[model samples]
Structure formats: C-alpha cells, structure tokens
Target: MEALLSQFSFLSSQALQDKNFDPTKIDDLMKFFELEAYNSWAAMETDLKKDVDEAEYTMKEAEDHLESVMDSAMDEFRRFEEELDRTLKDELDGLEQVANNAKKMGSSMENAATIATKKYMEAALVSATTTMKSAWKGLNFNSKKIHPS
Candidate 1:
C-alpha cells in the first residue's frame, strides 16, 4: 500500500513538473522589475496589485488542472475495482455449481447401493425357502417307503 502511495506521489510530482512553472524564478523576475522604487508610488501600487491578481489566477488554473487529472485517475481506479468484483463473483458462482453437482452424484451412488442391498436380501430369502421345502419332501418320502409293510 505504501508503494502505491509513493507511486501516486511521484506521478503527481511529475505532472506538476511538466507544467514548467517555477515559483522562485517568477519571484526573482518580479523583483527585478523594481516597481517598488518607481517615481509614482500610486502607479507602482496598482502595478503590484495587478501582478498579485495574475499570480492568483495562475495558481487557480494550476489547481483546476491538477484536480481534473486526479479525477480521471480515480475514475480509472473505480473501473478496475468493478471489474475485479465481477470476476470474483463469476468464479464463486462456478465453484458453487461444481459443489452442487458433486453432491447430486453422491446421492445417486448412495441410492444405487441401497437398491442393490435390498435385491440381495430378497434373493437370499427365496433361496432359503426352496432349500427347506426340498428337505421336508425328502424326509416324508423316506418314511412312506419304510412303512409300506
């Protein structure tokens, strides 16, 4: 986060430098004009007032320009944030679909296992019944043959 702030600061400084307006040089140039030592003090005062007004206007223009650039940067950042949010939401939705599908497959497998167990139990019961019936018939036939006197 600190790195991001430092980058922003550097960008802002570079933008200001690109304007090419040095306040120290402007002050020095104004001092060279020497309006303070003019013969007519009132005219000098008016000239000074005009210079101050011009400086104020220049400062305001610079501030407005910087504000515009900052606004554009913020708009770009907001767009990136919105896109990131959309991507994350889409990925989360896909993951949820996968999880639901896995759960459905598990349920199907459990139902198949239950059905197989029921079928096996029914087949075992039928086999046991047939074996018992066959044994009883054999015993009765043996007794009849022995008593035929």
Candidate 2:
C-alpha cells in the first residue's frame, strides 16, 4: 500500500515544463495520468476489500480504512478533474482567439477589396468621360451648320 501510494505520488508530481501541450499530446498525457490514478485507486480498493472479506480486522478498522481510501481517491479525482478543466478552458480560449483573428482578417480583406474596386471604378469613369468629351469636340458641334426645319 505504501509502495502504491508512493508510485502514485511520483507520477502525479511529474509535471511537464517548457513544453506546449497541444491537443493530441495533452489528450494522450491526460489519458495516461487518468489511467494510472484509476489503477492505483482500484488496486488499493481491491486489496482493502479482500482484507475485509478475509476478516483480517475489526469491523471498525475496516470502516476506517475504507473511509481513508475514499478520501484519498476523492482528492486524487478532484485534482485530475481540476487539471482537465483548466486544460480544456485553455484550449477553448485558444480556438476562440483563432476564430476571432480569422474574422478580423476577413473583414480587413473585404475593406481592401472595396477600396480597390472603388478606385478602379473611378478611374474607368474618368477615362470614359474624357474619351466622350474628345469625340464630341472632334465633331465641332459648336460650329454653325444650316438645317431645314
């Protein structure tokens, strides 16, 4: 029991540092951690149950041990839950940021395209107006021309 506790403690204490826990890696690590913790608790519970069945201790002692084991298991479970929650929150926040950035980029691109189209349209209008003015001038419309009514 002591050895099992020590092993669990050792594993729980092994924290990854200076590393990016991407989704895949984080998922894998969480799975392994969860498995180890669950196995440790299961082994402890099984052992205690066996002892109780074998009538190795007084009923009071068995109850106390069971309570102690439950408390320990709950503490471990809570720790794992909290860590998982934090990681999920972090990942969700990151995804939200990425979505926000994409939205901003799309808006920026739309603005740029609008501006470019406006400039091109203005240039085309000016060119057409100039060409029409020149064509009218070449016809000398201002010059007098006799016409039968």
TM-score, predicted candidate 2 vs. hidden true structure: 0.53
Going through the candidates in the order shown, the clash numbers are: 0, 0
C-alpha TM-scores of all predictions: 0.53, 0.53
Candidate 2 overall Cα lDDT vs. reference?
Answer: 0.82
lDDT of 1 at 119: 93
lDDT of 2 by residue, 2-64 (tens): 555565455445534324434564456567767878998999999989987778557778799
Candidate 1 segments whose C-alpha is farther than 4 A from its true place: 1-44, 134-149
lDDT of model 2, residue 20: 42
lDDT of 1 by residue, 22-122 (tens): 55654544454444435357787899999999999999999999999999999999999999999999999999999999999999999999999999999
Model 2: ten consecutive residues of lowest lDDT: 14-23
What's the lDDT for all of these models? 0.79, 0.82
